[model samples]
Target: MPPAPQAYRPATALLDLGPTFWDPVEGANFPGTIVRYRNDRAAAEVGLADLDDAEWVRHFGRFAPLPDTLPQPLALRYHGHQFRSYNPDIGDGRGFTFAQLYDRAGRLMDLGTKGSGQTPYSRFGDGRLTLKGGVREILATEMLEALNVPTSRTLSLIETGEELVRGDEPSPTRSAVLVRLSHGHIRIGTFQRLAYEQDEDGMRALVGYVLRRLYGEESDDPIRLLDHVVRRTATLAARYMAAGFVHGVLNSDNINVTGESFDYGPWRFAPSWDPNFTAAYFDQTGLYAFGRQPEAIHWDVMQLAASLRLVAESEPLIETLQTFASHYQPAIADALLWRLGVVPRGAEPDRALVQTLERALRTTAAPLDRTFFDLFGGTVPASYDAAWDGLRAALADYRPRKPSDHPYWQGEPCAMLIDEVEAIWAPIADSDDWSRLHAKVDAIRQMGEALA
Candidate 1:
């Protein structure tokens, strides 16, 4: 008998890069397999929308390899700096890349897991994800995508019947395993690992692989790769700021070559334009605060440049690192304009509008998300105070891109503040009611359509 034809095309591209980049491993046998969430929209993009609930759990929960994708999962190896301290002992501690395939657009995508089980990199810690943690990631990625931020889609989240002890949250929480749809699993830490070993050949091979596979280019020049990554990271940081988001941990390992945001942990959305607001409770120093995201990302890019120096020249990499500011400033302006539903004017005028808006936000007590909602489409409300004068002037000649007639525009703007997040979780924790979570996702999707 022959195997049945699958709907999606599978590829073993990562295996082609050879065994140095990753180690093959097996997934855990969970006691329970209950599908908590399924991303049908993202599934449609990958031709998996036809999968029934049973099939979804069989593939995602049991970690079964899709048809011809991967015979076994791969635990990727990498190292990164955590809180400015170098640590070479870190890698995929709780997850592995399960499968790879081309999306409908013919773009290569990876099905990576979180809390799927232990690996060589577990480092004396249990490889488990809290159910609450998985819920937070789902909310973060959905809200970010609705805000037009480039992020890895949360494909599936399945609750595993287990009790887990942890120090961060209340101990003995429920466990879960998450599947993420991402462009690639290769991180800056991937390059750093090669550089730390003084394996110049490995670094060279990795650069070629990244360019050929993820970037769709044919260049081995490490400097060129660094430049591309710097620009993309800059734009990513700017979008984070414009969206009033604080990615609590800006570790190099958390950032990937594709510049898409993934691996959510202790992330938060800013209520107002406060620079000192931090996300992670342990980040008492505010190193990755709401305002310092650009600086943190710039420092990460510098680390990448230093890693690339193992194979490339010094001056060009240094020069490429310096371009972060040039890319970031314009990107934030454009991102803010897009959120406000206004068309772009020239660079200088758009910048002025952003600066004025920031200044106004600082002087008032209004939440940043609400401020954006009120002044959407360049309309300065008559109810606004004198603090909005500068912003009103800045937007005087600008016209809105579209009328604020989307049904969502009439009511309050959707906000993922901590209080709201907790409110949504309370029902599920108490009685397994998921109505609020479902409703929130629907509202965020509507907002995305309106913004588009």
Candidate 2:
């Protein structure tokens, strides 16, 4: 009655997919391999950890039963606007959804595999994803999550023993498939597919189904459904700006209608707050740039609103669409303030605060001493006073007689304060002095346990 505690589907799905979605990619049938296996404890909090190798491969890869597990293949239908042009043929071309499970903390999660193998949707190209794609996605997830952005979590990457040919990068390089967990895989294009075809009955069925599954209500009403999607989308854009992330491809297919950040292809963080920064290799026009993400999100939302117009009034829908600005600014400001360790001024827009906020991105100019912003709680060396002071000096209005006396980190007894972060994400290679940094991470974990 309360949504089955996780990403559980009706038993009817078992009967629906049958044996098709259960077929695994034989050998290196996929350009990539499923090698490494890892779990995310933080992601597990959202009921994701349970979809381990055994449960995941069978469902996602469409492999036959090796043991007790759920049979849910990864296949969905959707259409999208590619480079400002509408394209009707697009879906899970080379990936599949394996299983939805409860993580360690009991949150609903979907485990899906990319570059797994060929699917019904594979058009003309080889049904595979490149190793570099996996690496880029891993970095995207790490950087965004560290900044507290809502995004899909990259769980594991496998380097297939075999080599696959690709156009870009190097030939016969390596091959890999990534296992990522997310809140939902459904997208706006999913509904638009049928809606645009003038299939009114089909659109009604799809919208109603999505509402019951994703929005937690059984509503045939299009207004509530559209508004719910708009609200979630507004928060998503706000979070993106807050974390300085750019989803290089904000096409309708890539924009998750459920509002969960999905599809990590060609995503990048602002190296230094350059608005035009793009992560995609072929983004010639910079449609999905860092500064344009909010606009891009709205554009995608409008498309969804347009599709929903088949059943809903345009007047009320326009108001819903207009509310994006009302919600995004405050949320983005809060995120910026938190990242800079500045106390929030509250719900009203803080013009002075906005100007001061620019200093955080300017790490070199004013040199806010002892700067720091970790998604996790502070504890690592980056969380130390040295990091803090480096950040404060960057602000415009500040009068500090001594370099170390900046207000941001110049409070109270110096020795009494403690900053603890569970893990530091720097490379373990040499410069990290891996052994030493590891010990620090362990010590922080131990300290956290003791405090708990």
Best by lDDT: 1
For 1-452, candidate 2 gives per-residue lDDT tens digits of 22223333322222232342133333224433354434344444544346767565443333443233344355666788876789887777777666555544333456667776666677885656666676566656654565556778776666554577877655775566776777667678876776678767766776776576556686878778777787778778877776666787888888886787877776655545666778688998888887788888888888888888877789988888888887777767666655544455545434445554454345333222222323112222333344334333333332322223233233321110112111222232224233533344334333223212
Tens digits of per-residue lDDT, candidate 1, 198-273, equal: 9988898999988888888889889889978988898899999988999899999988888999999999999998
Error of 1 at 431 (Å): 0.5
TM per prediction: 0.97, 0.73
Per-candidate count of clashing residue pairs (backbone under 3 Å): 0, 38
Return the TM-score for candidate 1, rounded to 2 decimals: 0.97
Residue 249 local lDDT, model 2: 86
Error of 2 at 405 (Å): 18
